[model samples]
Target chain A: MKLKAPECVFSSAGFCPGCGHGLASRLVGETAEELNIVEKLVTVVDVACCSFNIDYWNFDTIMAAHGRDIPTAVGVKHVRPGCPVLAYMGDGAAYSIGMAETIHAALRNDPVTVIVINNSVFGMTGGQMAPTTLPGERTATSPKGKDPARYGTLSGVELLKGMDIAYLARAELVGVGGMAKAKRYIKKALEHQLNGDGFSLVELLSPCPTNLNLPPVKAKQFVHEEMTKYFPLGEFIDKGGDK
Target chain B: MSKVKLNIARCKGCGYCVDECPKQAISFTGRISEKGYDTIQVDDEKCIACGSCYRVCPDSVFEILV
Candidate 1:
């Protein structure tokens, strides 16, 4: 068994050390390869850390305006219905600034796959407190740590649940088990697109070591231990799967 | 026996793979990579090709050949 890097993954990425965007993009590439949709893949990335996927993945990519990736992907799908369009964004883009677009896409059940990298902070910019920022989590903006009463957290999966989407799930990238589960969820989301099912979204709990001010190892542990407690893992909704 | 290869130049020394390796087969080589971070090496004798390192590496550093 020789595990080779995905062919769709080209030159090195620009993410900071221990950033989970690299791994998340690699999983997308691998999923595209397995589904044999590389040539037909059009990724619309948000103007955040996730924009790095435009370089990491060897696919037709569009760097959309901040927090507009979902609608941008919807537009691409409208013109190129055959292409498997993916909206790649971070929690800040998907849950914060792009909240309306994100919700309406699921409400309309648009045929696009949205992968949100939830790192709990505004990664590319300074480490500001994002919508997904855990209560008591320290960020640049929340120097004293996020206050639950003052600033509550938002869970993408929770907001999108009960919608008529094709699939919905959340997974992390902490250990081998988590990564494996994330790949499975991602592959399923892409499969739903090929099947022409409505919208699909997979929120990946990733580590922002630079923003969290933790070392790589500790960041991984933080997501595995602390983040999962708030945003539990597993498929929240699988319309196509057996109930 | 199995082997894990490294793309030494692209490494950022995040040490995710080093910590994820269940066999404890990988370690920092003390030599700096082109990225100016300590590069890691694998002990082939201790490696079991579990692919944990390959799965956890953010930079795609390891390729496991069994």
Candidate 2:
């Protein structure tokens, strides 16, 4: 299947200077199509910056209110029956505002695939903080930097693994190596959803220098360093294994 | 006697290979591809065929015929 034939084009149509979101999003869309999920794809975008992705997508894309993308996707999955869905959102919407929806969806084992773009800070909302913000990280909200003593632990992969979801992975789009592994996880997630299993979420530690107030290169290095320390790279849970 | 291959598209023109070449065989004159990415070139004589370029590229653009 010729997959890049999506309904969007042009670099400006969907990407930041060094945003790995575009790379991961295109791969997901194209891979889903190759796996025959495009025709059945009903992407639910949240109130986060990914809302613009709705306009750039070629499949059934919908703009949902803050933190409600999960239920919206679940609703679409329940009604559409066999249609595959990819619920893409940023950390702010998924881990913070949408936490309730995420938990319920996972608890009920909704047949939906989720693509969580964890750029650490809320890129769209003025580079503020998010639950997934790395420790000792400085954000617009956390101007003094994130204090672990007050915030506690933060790891989306670990958090989701505790949910008992059918498929879950936390990877990065930092480089070609990471992108390659992420592509495999995306393909697997779509198949899991289409096959009528529980929830599948792929948390991508994306780069957002524009928001993070760092150069693109430095931002990427942050993912490979600080971010990877808290979240840690590799498959946190796959087919329900510790590895 | 060995194979040295490359994916020119992935070469980001960083010149990491040019500086690190112990043989001083690699030279980059800023020639870019249709993809607008500057690629690396090899001065075959200076190349000891040690595969340093293969080791350095983050994209793994270099391939050595083992």
Candidate 3:
């Protein structure tokens, strides 16, 4: 039997060739469609690569300044308490500039779903090194590779280790299996918010082939082989509804 | 046999479908898409319509007919 394709209203997104943000955005749209929340979902997008998705997804979306998506989403949730709110951000916006906002939201248990595309590089600004950049991985800023001895690689999800978070998980978008897992994690994070569970976050290890200076196929392999070594995938916390 | 269709105009030729196809049924055509990228062509006889391409394609370029 043929599976029903997700009804993404936009025929195409403006993302570059082989960019995982398009796939991640589609998965989130699919989840919203599956849950029948497309009409009631509100999105707060940060001013990074993720901001481009406002045109791709057919939902009520608000653009937030760099690293302020969490606060904007929190405010949206307060005004539209009956609807589900999602904050979409890239690693540069979420892990680096918006780290404090993300941490406070997780700590306060704000009823919002946060999706972080941890592509390790600042893809929009010409592949600059991000906080989530892997150790020894070269980028525009880290031309000689990231030296952990000088600057430590930060794991954003790990910051919520002892905090009271509703749901926290990390998944990559590489092969079929990885994509499937990412869909599940994204759906679950959204579900938690609909069920009135506290702040939920799903960090997706997406690929940036153009920025990474690798072919699209090899970029997916790099995600599975090299990226996973630094950022392991799995559920870190789940204290929301029964799974 | 299941049928596979490609939206040649929409494809970016990233080869995600080619890499993920379990049957090795998908390949890039030498012909360039309107977008100026090599588009993929599916070998229908080899395709099982497993939907791996449908699932992994970031561009929503494939449609599987069962």
Query: Could you report the DockQ of all the candidates, in the order they appear?
Result: 0.84, 0.07, 0.72
lDDT of 2 at A175: 57
- Give me the candidate number with maximum DockQ: 1
Q: How accurate is candidate 3 locally (lDDT)?
A: 0.88
Q: Give the runs in model 1 whose Cα sits over 4 Å from its true position.
A: A241-243
lDDT (10s digit) by residue, model 3, range A1-243: 475456754667777778898889889888999999999999999997888888888999999989999999999999999999999999888889898999999889999999999998999899988888889999999999999998888998888878998899999988889999999999999888888888999999988998999999999889989989989999998875664
Please report how far candidate 2 places residue A109 from its true position, in Å. Answer: 0.7
Report, to 2 decimal places, the DockQ of model 2.
Answer: 0.07
Ranking by lDDT: 1, 3, 2
Q: Tell me the docking grade of candidate 1.
A: high
**What TM-score goes with each of the models?**
0.97, 0.75, 0.97
In candidate 2, what are the lDDT values of residues A52-103, reduced to their tens digit?
6765667778888898988999888878887887889988888888888887
Give residue A199's error in model 2 in angstroms. 1.0
I-RMSD for candidate 1: 0.8
How large is the C-alpha RMSD of every model relative to the true structure?
1.4, 6.7, 1.3
Model 1: per-residue Cα lDDT over A1-243, one tens digit each? 688789899867888888899899889988999989999999999997888777788999999999998999999999999899999999989989999999999999999999999998999899999889999999999999999999888888998887889999999988899999999999999988888888999999999999899998999999999999999999988776532
Between candidates 1 and 2, which one is better according to TM-score? 1
